[model samples]
Structures are given as structure tokens and as C-alpha cells.
Target: MKGIRGRYGQMKVLETELDSTVKLLDTTIFNKDNFYNALGRQQDFIIRPLLGPQKIRVNPVNNSLYIIESTNNKQHFTNSEDVYEHLLKHEFTKKNYVIQTVPANNQSVLHYHRFTLHRISSSSNWKVVHHSITGGNELGKIRHALPFLKFNKVVRNAANLLGNYYLACNTIVIEILQNKMGETWITDTILHERNSKWSQFHSLYSCKALRSYIPHTELCTKESLGKFLQSLRQVVLKPCVGQQGKGIVKVTKLDDNTFEIHENKQIININDFAKLYDYIHNHYLSKNDYIVQQFIVIGKIDDRLFDVRVMSQLDETEWIITGVLVKVATKGFFISNRASQLLTLEEALIWSNSKISFDKCVSLINEICGKASVVLEKNCKGITIIGFDIAIDSNGALWIIEGNYAPSTAMFYKFKYNEMYETIYKYINKNKKRFSPHSD
Candidate 1:
């Protein structure tokens, strides 16, 4: 009974504080006459007294929120929800306010302001107030009040507010930037394989299967491995846990006298099979689970090997293709990526189709991308963007080489320049619209 009474007393005090702060904001607006004067003007002018004269109005409808700060004249809407949430989370209702306004005639001239109350009710305590002004239908009459300020305070003090939900929404935005997918889709091997949905796709070999869908491959012993290697003409060994084209070797038997060893195109002739076996046994196969995959003869472009990177993103309802680029290998190297050298998709298509049709190559490339997305989404759920690296075989069949979660847009933007940048900007803005407060 005592605890409940104490809690009630605290709530009453908070309510009183909110009421006092709101009245203070109301008095400031009515006393200054500056805000009313601006509202009475027939011509549009942003009144941004909150952060001072230097801070431009941040009305979302205007799209000129940061016009004064930026030289490019492009207005970028910085997400202010995080700041709002911080105040609410810390129960700083006495220091927070929300802007209420009528629709503006031009919609682009409205402004938002934030003011600090240095001495509320003749006390040394400080508080923050937010205000918004918009043009109204009436010629010189405008309705203005601190109603939203009170409502926002009420919501902030409520026990079951949507504060956590709003925080989650903000976190989703942050995750998009940080590329933190989290550990959601990682499951068992059979399930992961089933999710991949590609019959030809195989899992990387590891001692303990990391993904539930991929089967744990057994390490090769000398007796069983010798029998396995004898059955194949050549095999490429890859580190199961490695990335970025590292720790890969191709072993092929030439004749009874010699064997060829290839590492990213550098070749060496080894006469002692025992020494070669010791090298593989000691360095690669000794400790880690390694996979012996069949070598793929990738199609050449301009007499140089290249792979296509198709980028895609998931919007509100559907997954859309953002752009594609070709990662061309350096003069002597075989792998093609930014780490190697990147070429525009158009350039690669042109070079590849000097002896073939560009349309045909694109069709094949799109098909591979479609399949890769299906396979990837099966393994990973709620994946918004992905880059699929694909290679075309001499037989014209497309092969999925790898997939990247956070793909680079540098090559795509560099190739198309302004056009691609604008496209991406528009896409981000569209997503922002989906999360507008009105959408709630």
C-alpha cells in the first residue's frame, strides 16, 4: 500500500511538471508575437528561432530542411526519431514537445523550431520546446497552440507507450546501414540446403557443420583419400571457412612422373608425389575440413576472365534489381572482383558479345541471378539486398560462384555516375516514405 501510494505521488508530480512546462511554451508563443506575425504573412517564410537564425527550418514537406547548411541545395532529412526516443526513454517529458500545424499553401515554406526554456516558472530548471508553423487556407488567420506538446508529454508518460516498437523501427534503419543481419536464418544443414533451393549448390566443408542445412563433410584419411583422389583426373581444394578467394589449390596428375600444382594461376611442377602429399597433408588438409570440388572452366571476356555481380534489394512488397557490374580479372590473374579490377556491366557485355549477342548473355545472367536469389533467401530470411557473383561456363550454362550480403555500389555508381546515384537516392527516399508518421 505504501509503495503504490509513493508511485502515485511521483506520477502526480510528473503530470504537474508537464502541465507547467506546456503552459510556459504557450506563454512564450503568445507573448513574443513573432510567431503570429510570421503566420500572418501572405508570402511563405520559414521561422526557425529554435536553433537560432543559422538553423534552417526542418519541415519534412518543404524538402529544404538543410538548405542553409548544404551548398549542393539538396535537402537531406536526418532521422530525428532517435533523439525523440532518447528524451522519452529517459522520462524527459518536461523537456520535450511536438509540433502541430495547418497545411501550408506551397507546402515547401513551412519551418520547425526547437527552443530552450532557461527558467521555467522563475526557477533555474531548463526545458526544451519544439514548434512547427504552416500556412493555412485562411488569408491571414492561422490556428496555433501547444496541444501537441501536451499530447506528446502524455504519450511519453504513458505506461504502455509504443516506445519500444519505435525503437525497433529505428534499429531496423540502423541495421540497414550497418549490414547487421543478425543470427536468424542460420539453422540445420538439411533445412539450410532445402532453403537454398538450388540442386547444384553445395555447402562448404567444415569439421562441425555450422549451418543446419549443410551436411558435415568427413575429413579424408590417407587410406580413404588416396582411393578418392585416384578416381578423379583433377580436384581443387578450398578452405571451407575462408573467404575472398584465399587458400585454394588445384592438384592435377600429368603422367606417372609428375603432378601439376596450381594456386590462383601460378603453377609448379612437382616430381615427388610423397612431398606433394606431405605439403597438402601438413598445410591444408591436416587440421581443417577441406572440399575437393570439380574445376570449372569459366567463359572468357575480351580474352580475360570475368564474373558478373548482380545486386538486388527487397522493397515493401517485392525484390527489385538495383544494378549489376562485372568484376574483371587483372591481366595475369583469374579471379575477377574489385580486389582484382572492376568493369561496368555494359563494358563486359560488349566485350563478351564481340563474338556473341549481348541480349543472349544478359538473359543467361538474369536467369542465374533469379536462381541465386531463390537459393539465398531460402538459407537467409528477410535479406533485403544481396550481390550474386556468377560465371558462365564454355557450355553456356551459368554457375553461381558466391553471394555477398553487403555488396558495394561503387562500381555501379561509377559506371552510370549521376543516374545510378539518383536512382539509389530515390529508392532510399521511397523507403523513408513508407515509415512516415502518417503511415502509422
Candidate 2:
């Protein structure tokens, strides 16, 4: 039977008894014929290329190089030539700065990704500890883990561990695949700014728990917006630190230079990208910073775009999915904050085009969010309950929209899921002692 993706989102065909081997897709042109074998079935951990900008930096302590950005970049360098020169300057004679044989596409695509691999135990090979039911690293089914180290001098020197993340555990084994098509593959590194929209995207982009859930996001710029609008039918512009969807604009490209921007209940048409960019800057970014994201056409039911918000709380040491709600965006708008209606997972998916059964959907949500909650706690401290905003694509694939640290529980109370509402308060009351033990 045909099943599972190999590379570039292609399904692999298994051969008959006579062949007893896997066949590749003709449509997916990979430089290596054995790309599947390379990516398939890792024993210790799964480390693959992140599809976006590539920025190289020297890890001076060990004299190694890293392709810095996990996905998108903020355009530090004006062009790719600058990035190449930067890479060449940081070259270490011992290791080649780049290696060819990229698995995704052969043409002008900068291949840059980093992942830490570790030896499981004395007897085990270095590999990922676990994957979700369907398996594979993507799909947010990945687990957060770092191979526990013994207290010793050998462990103290990080160079002893594998490459990739952080200084010392360098199992990344990055091989820069130069662009063959001659077009410069875009490359820019990350400069982390906390609490902003990009910070959330950065933390989860290659996170062991939520990498697959993050959408491609970058600082809004004339260059970045133009690129996003050309490739994506729609791109969302939002204040980097706004709440309740106050300054979010959904721009849909109608034709060459023509565009549509939706805000609140108003839709305005613009004829040029320059004009659109100028208008957004004047209206939304005059005082605050903004970010542009490749918009996912969140699955719609009854002509209303909607997404799922999973309420997660700590049940002792383990984070549990306490409740799930389908936030139905206000009609003629995509933001779910102004939800016209809220429905249980069953209520919404029953009417949804999602082919998966309700039970399976719940199962996936728990599996994906289970890992997400762990990462959330590590990144966001002093927090126990989280509202994970998840997008349900047309084909029923779930992608994380973002997490609400101070999520509102009123929806659960208003939607007649009082049990869920009470459950939330139950968690809050229970966890009160965890933070503050002083009692009346």
C-alpha cells in the first residue's frame, strides 16, 4: 500500500515482492536518488534541512560553523552575495564550510538547518527518543529531550558531544548545498527579541516539540512583504506585541500589484504593493513594530474561517489537554478572537470536511500539544495554564497558530462547556499553592 512521505512532501511507493524496494517520485527532483534512505529511519535523532534563509556564524570556541536561522530571517544582509562572503570569511580550514547533495530541491535553495543529536545510552545509538503515532520529526509529534550527562570532566567539555545546537553537542553535521541554478538563495541570521511574535515563532520553529507547528514569519519590510505576497495568496500583518487581534490586517493578492486588505469589518483594495506597504506602515506601524507571516487559509465551515484553541493545564507533573474549542472567526473576517460561535471538537469537525474521525483528531491534538506544553513551560516561566491556538488546514492537517499565555476561559463557560470552565478554575486553584504557599 502507498503511505508516508519520503521527501518534498511526496508519497513513497513500495515495490512488489519481486522488487522488494521503495520507489521514488519522478515529480520530486532530488540530487540524491537515495534521499529517502538518507532521511528515513534514523536511530538516535532526526536532523534535516530547514527550508528558508541560511546564515553562517563561527562557533569560535570549537572552530566550527553553523547555519544560524532555522526558517525565515530578518534580512540582516541586503543580498545573498553578502551572506556568501560572510561564510567564506569565517571558513575553518579543518572542515569545509558547505557540502552539496541537498535533499529538498537542487535549484537555488539555500539549505540551512540545525538539530542536536545525542547518544541515548552506553548501548544505544544517538537518536530521537520518541515520535508521535504517525511518526517522523515534522508535524509537532517530536519530543523535547537532551541526553542526560554524567557529572564528569569528559561531560564538562561540550565538544565531546554531537554537533548542531549550542557549543559542544555538535551532531548537526551541517553540509551547505550551494545553489546550482545560479540564483542567490536568501540567507539572514536571527537576533532574538523576547515576547514579540517572532520570538514565539523562533522558540518553536526548530523546537523538539513544536517546530512543525510554527508558520514562516519575519519582520515586515518592503522586501519581505513583496516576497511573501508573490508566493502566498494572502499574508497577515500584525503588531509584534498586540493582543485581541486589534491591529491585524489580512492582505489577499488579487492580481499583479492589486491587493485586498481586511481589517475589522472593512475591506480596502489597493493597486500596488508599494501603496499597500505604505498604507499598512502609516496605519498599523506608525508607533508599533509589525511582522508579516505567510497566512494559512484556516479551514472554513459554513463559510466562516475557524481554528482550534486547546486549553492545557498542569495535572501534577504532566501537562494535560483539559479542553479544546473551535474558535469560529467573525463572518467576513479571519480572526477568531471575535468568534461568532464556539463549538466542541466533535461539533465542529462533524460539519467540517476533515476526513479524519473525531477520535483520531483528539488523539492527534493530545500528542502534538503534549510536547508543546513542555516547551511552553521552559520558554514561558511562572505559567501553568496555556491556550494553544492551532490551525486546522483544509485537508485537516493541524498547524500551531500560537499559544495564549493568559488565555480567557469565558468561551468554555459561555459555550455551555461549564465542565471545562470549572476544570480550568479547578487547575488554577490547585496550582495556587505551587506558586504561593501562603494561606489564609
| Every candidate's lDDT | 0.42, 0.55
Best by lDDT: 2
Clashing pairs in 1: 187-212, 188-212, 188-213, 189-212, 189-213, 189-214, 190-213, 192-213, 196-375
- My TM-score estimates for the predictions, one after another, are 0.44, 0.57
Candidate 1 error regions (>4 Å): 1-234, 264-266, 272-274, 338-340, 353-356, 416-440
Error of 2 at 28 (Å): 56
- Over the stretch 1-440, how does candidate 2's per-residue lDDT look in tens digits? 21112122211221111121211222232222332332232211112222222222211111122232212222244433453454445322222112212223433333222222233122223332111111123322232111122112212222122211222121211111223342221111122223456556644654655666677776675666887989988999977667888898899999997999999889989998788877876576543557799788777889998889899999878999888889898888878889998888888887777766789888889988888778656655567888888888887778887777788888898977669888888898888876675854
Name the lDDT of candidate 2: 0.55
Error of 2 at 251 (Å): 0.8
Residue-wise C-alpha lDDT for candidate 1, range 288-324, written one tens digit per residue:
4354555556666767778777776666756566666
